[model samples]
Target chain A: MSIKTSILSSIGQKLLLATSGLIMFLLFLIPHMGGNVLFLFGPDMFNSYAHHLHQLVPIVIGIELLMLTSISVHMIMAFRVVLANRKAADKRHTLKSSKERSLAARLMPVSGIMIFIFIVKHLLDFKFYEKAKTTLHGVETYDVYAMVLSRFQGDPVHLVFYVLFMVAVGFHLSHALQSSIQTYGIYVPREGSKIKLISAVVGWGMAATFAIIPIFAFIK
Target chain B: MSKQINLTLKVWRQNRGEEGKFETYEAKNIDTDASFLEMLDVVNDELTLKGIEPIAFEHDCREGICGCCGSTVNGKTHGSHERTTLCQLHMRHFEDGQNVVIEPFRATAFPVIKDLIVDRSGLDEIIAEGGYVSVKTGNAPEASTTPIKKEMAEAAMDAAECIGCGACVAACPNGSAMLFTSAKVSQYALLPQGHPERAQRVKNMVAKMDELGFGNCSNEYECAVSCPKGIDVKNIARLNREFIKANLGKN
Candidate 1:
């Protein structure tokens, strides 16, 4: 009984990870964009919203932990599947052949890893560092929202990195969503066509939403 | 209106095994109403008249049903149109002065046997590796007894239409046989007759597909795109799920 469910669970696990990953990405992005809209009220309002999150420290910490775990599991499973495919393909030919799959599917693992690295840097810059240490402006616990925006605006380095990271995220979601649907057994022509369309729209939406924040931050 | 169209053909020529090169020929004014394969017939007839060996290619039903006339024409499989096969491809798609590049199917498993003809037995090898309904025919109950849903039946039929041509493998950059083998597996797996060997079938077929020097399905779907019979990539997806379930010891 235990083995049976676990076996079934492995198949579900990948779909679950992908579904939850996509949800969390969209959830965080939508609200994050909404919060950025507060920038229209000036940097102070944005800074104050960041302070409110700090005040709700317990809830913030809890959500952070959950997000971290979800992300880790998703990344691990995705990487495992990618590695398995690589090994499976390699064992067959022995001689390396050029990519025979679509460009999107072929580069999924590399793109995913890049997005993962970007996420880590993102957390360190805005979330952890600001929470752990004082800012150079002599403010304790940091003015994270402002600090982030200022980095994008004044630092060309940060702006370029953010844009590149968003592009990677877009491509990752585009391929992952389409392939994940296929992975889960929804491959009929009609459904497959719908999935492809939805994946493209969602992927572009994610990249655009993320890009909006950086663009606004740069200008303001 | 069937306008007369003059076209130059650049076709891959090979006398025998493994070695082949492209040879160019000027096809005189031909009726644009002819099917792409019919146009090829004209060239072959002219070659025979001149005592030159006619180009060798494979085709069975010219109705796009046999899946035998698989080739890359002008860089697209089965000609430029989507969901169209070579026999179904008409000369109307080409311009008068256009140069058509005709080549044999290319893949590690599909070795070229002659000019524009490849040995696609790799597909059969994968299929035989376990792409079947193992249930004994006489011992089985009535077909209506199982009562499968109409949708599933239709989907199974769609997959079953795959004629084991290696066009999907040729179109795919990775030479993945996932579409071909998976469609075969899914066609049977989707049906009631497929129940007995469900687990073993997917496992054996997938393993065989990989062992035959085919690439893993990355879901680029070029296989579905170039399939002359329009075998959907969904079959490949179903195959993936079936394999994962089998590997994990689930039915």
Candidate 2:
């Protein structure tokens, strides 16, 4: 009856999660993907892109807050749904077998938690870290691109971590995309296969594109 | 008529609202062509002759149309066969000297009445919330009165195939009835007759489902897989959409 109670219902919570997740993907992930492409174009272009982003301080801060809010909402709803689902089935099955569910679907919560950790670490290392000294003509410049390059190229551990996180992203997105579509009730029976295929393609594409940047940074 | 087989059945036995356990029973010389329920009948006959308590289960049509008879066989709701109810599952699917595990549908809402018989009246209560269209009592309208699209009618029929068996809840690890709820919602949501009450129908049904202790669908899709009617998980999505539309007053 009330708006809050209506949204807090099991299905309502899921819808909220799906809707927020899609918005996060569009607002944060797509732009992040586009920006990561700059890594391939050498340090100058990448640094300039980073600088341009910094130039729009107010807008950037607003977008960052919005992204944070989206992630927080998505995560809270997910946790509630998980708790409700657990409570609903208090008795665990002795023999567990799920043949129809996709691996990505099964691994959603696990991958989600991992992705949360990765996002926090990523922000701390790249966004929050400030003192990167690059000396050009005996003058030190706070170099964003140089910082990224050093983090990826200098540390094999960081590279591996980045790649692993991308894989987790792939797992989450593969299920999330089609799930979001379904949650929004956009399914046509005839296009079911196509929807699944597209979700897979987009998920893997985003992951691969993001993952390739760290690999290219190390190798090149 | 196939060769007869003997099966060691591990059937769940419990009294009303009490702790239950698996009670082993030997079903000997069972006809391979006989239905799974028929095999159970043979076992029950042996138990009765031995002055032991017979296994209690539910059945009506024995033709798969009635949703009454449902048991988890070897951790599979409605037996191991896809889209097949327990009454329709033949004994030929099993091997000689096999160990078959039969249990009642487990869910908070569907408490076991006794043995394999569970009180699935929770499903009926969910239906009663809003599973129908209101119509005045009168002569039936002409068949061609409302022109529905071929695809829409087919999709609606696909959803309407749900027999209201608690297989979806039983098969689900989370015991979610989203599949059943979605199927019922979609059946009417797809038809024009169901239009007037579409918003209210989904809202009430979903509310009752959650209120009755059915789990939220985590997209595990086990419900869809174990459903006797082969109901699509897409219906769950449609239910989500309908719920959103209803809440937003768009419907």
Candidate 3:
């Protein structure tokens, strides 16, 4: 079979999705979290961080390309698998029970879609928006901290949307964390519950920390 | 005398290649000690006595070992109790004057053959693909010669408990057979005898399962819950791991 068809097959699609998701979580998520945390350190720290990131244009572009590719692969594979799963089962159960399935597991696709939208909107607001810049020490750099505060401080709707998206990210990661491990075949039966708990904590923790940044920006 | 309960059964009836509907039947005075299949037999006997066609369901062993008997009772596969097959579920679990709805295991892959009977040969086709060890007969070592760890043995045995029953597919919302296929893969993957052809075995079997119209697993653990053998869903994870490992270097 051709490599493309092989990867499109059931098991292959899942492997690609899980691997890409884990990679994005490691490379993109960690750096994004670090940058957002700089918001709490006040304007100079956050703006200087943005200025430093701007200086490494080539490296930033490389990482951005990789992130785009990873996100595309992950989303495409997920959609194919979900659609195939729906087509495979032609009937629905009249009486259903959720004793085994978690809410996060069931809502993965929904949360994924939300996260996708949030990512695009976030990029538009912070990365591509042509806002006025402030010159610091005779160097013109984008005032990212001011832009963030302006977006949240006076706009309740924007703040709510951001917080809601963060919640969606939390739900998505709760399942994805443990699921990625399973895809890699690292399951220890005795530690199943422990793994699930850890996944939940990490997922919610990342989401909460990110959400707190905007809320803090608005209130401060 | 055993306590007897009368039940109202709404059993699905359909002929080969025909549309089916529910036909209500009254099963009166069934012994609480009777197996679920036996209770169905009692209903069929009454229908026969009334000069009416009896219900058609599949069953060979009254004992639960044979995977022949399966029916969705009250929206639960093999009945409401967990880990109990249709043949082993006792009538005592039901109250008098209760209503039970029975239907065939519904899936695109598992078509209705008759009342409460479905064609599960698709599962057999998956097993036929690569679900066996092909070691030479004379080269087989004595059982004691193979020193398997206790934990691994127990895990293998747990996976081996899968009776090839299609309950996993029936119970799943997506009708995925990943649990059943994964259990088979795990059973052999854990044993040394199955090491030689591990790569081909998982690859061929998974391809066949997908080809046979089984859905992809979306991490819903319903299959494990509905399994009569209580086969763990972790096997599915292991199957994924094996699939990735098998195809690591190849294009």
Candidate 4:
């Protein structure tokens, strides 16, 4: 890309990643999460469901690829925007001082990187390799579903990590989702307040949905 | 929770020029439900009927939509209430026999024009720099033609709600116009209508804001708190992002 195209495309890419990520989380991730917490329905039911999903190899692979690409684009654009913001701010201050960004806003880039890594690990452990599960009865069974459940029920460290990650995701989404929509310039005058409310609600849904998985496992 | 109140109003009084003084006036039997501007209106009416220069202040749209009514009332921009304009602030916030101090909105860019009216024309100039859609007529398309998502549309509108009030500058310790300018920049930059001149717009607006001598936004949240429109500081974050993208090159 030329300097001009890259600059414009960078903004375009950021908008795409942000808006897509928001929809993915709100419409897909939250509902998926509701179905993922299988302790209430027992391991057998959840395992069969997982097996059935695994049977759709091509479709699942396609989705995973699309998700990976989308997520990578989101992270790359996020870091670029954050760096550029800092640079612009520094120039304005001319080495005299710095602009004050909130702790939550400032932490977005760093927290985003962590969340990116955690997401990869999450997909691998639960959906891809079943790495969380090891040899079982000399059969090399990787009960992907059970591995996720075991983390909350048996592994305190994993449970804690899960909860912490969810909280970070909540904070990130609160700023990111609202900001991304703004960056893209899509709201109407009459609907502005409703969108703000929607942003908050989506943030809460992400936090609460992700939170439920760990809490249910830990308690039951 | 209502009560009759007596207030000692130390309002700024000046005939002309930079020289001015806080003249005390007793406003008795003040209704607690009355807005701060309304109370001032009552006082001004009394002054007007008495053949005096009715306290020489500025106000418009006492409904709080217009950003015209602004002053430093008791050390707070737009009065003590958070995210409120002077018109929205009611007397019930204060007690009877309380001393209320009212002064002009002080800032380098906002020079005092009269008793309470400050020259906010700087903001207008900054807006004129690139705060508009440059798309030519005859080829202009409908807004609905763009398939913008509901989420992005809302954010842009929120930023656009900023009524050109300099409260953000007044609230800033550095006297930064980032919040105000950013809101203007973001509203356009976020939309496709602003795409043609996006890079130049941000760069030019920032340059103008700086040329106008407004301070930097240090994220004090005071601007957000004091903003009658409640423009969030997140727009500043987006502004920083837009500035960076703009500086890289024009697309």
Kindly report, for each predicted structure in the order presented, the TM-score of its chain A compared with the true chain A: 0.75, 0.91, 0.93, 0.75
Q: Of models 1 and 4, which has the larger TM-score?
A: 1
lDDT digits (tens) for residues A85-177 of candidate 3: 888777644436546778898899999999999999999988888766877667888898999999899888999999999999999999998
Here, model 4's chain A TM-score works out at 0.75
Q: What TM-score does candidate 1 get on C-alpha atoms?
A: 0.74
Please tell me the TM-score of chain B in candidate 4 relative to the true structure's chain B: 0.93
Q: Which pairs of residues have clashing backbones in candidate 1?
A: A100-B173, A100-B174, A187-B234
Q: What ranges in model 3 sit over 4 Å off?
A: A1-5, A188-192, B138-147, B249-251
Per-prediction TM-score = 0.74, 0.94, 0.94, 0.54
Poorly placed runs, candidate 2 (over 4 Å):
A133-141, A188-192, B142-150
Candidate RMSDs in order: 6.2, 2.3, 2.3, 10.8
Residue A30: error of model 1 in Å?
Answer: 8.2
Tens digits of lDDT, candidate 2, B5-110? 9999999999997989998999999999999999999999999999999999999999999899998888888888899999999999999999999888888778
Kindly list the per-residue Cα lDDT of model 1 for residues B1-251, writing each as its tens digit.
Answer: 89989899999887655457888887777788999888889999999998988989899998877878878787677777878888888888888898988887777677778888887887888878787665545775765788999999999999999887777777766577878888888888888778778888877776666556665555676777677777877787788778767767787
Model 2: how far residue B218 lies from native, Å? 2.6
Give the number of the best model, judged by DockQ. Answer: 3
Score each candidate by Cα lDDT.
Answer: 0.73, 0.87, 0.87, 0.70
**Docking quality (DockQ) for each candidate:** 0.19, 0.50, 0.53, 0.02
> What local lDDT does model 2 show for residue B50?
99
Better of 1 and 2 by lDDT: 2
**lDDT of each residue in B210-243, candidate 3, tens digit only:** 8988888777678888889899878988898888
What is residue A121's positional error in candidate 1, in angstroms?
A: 6.0
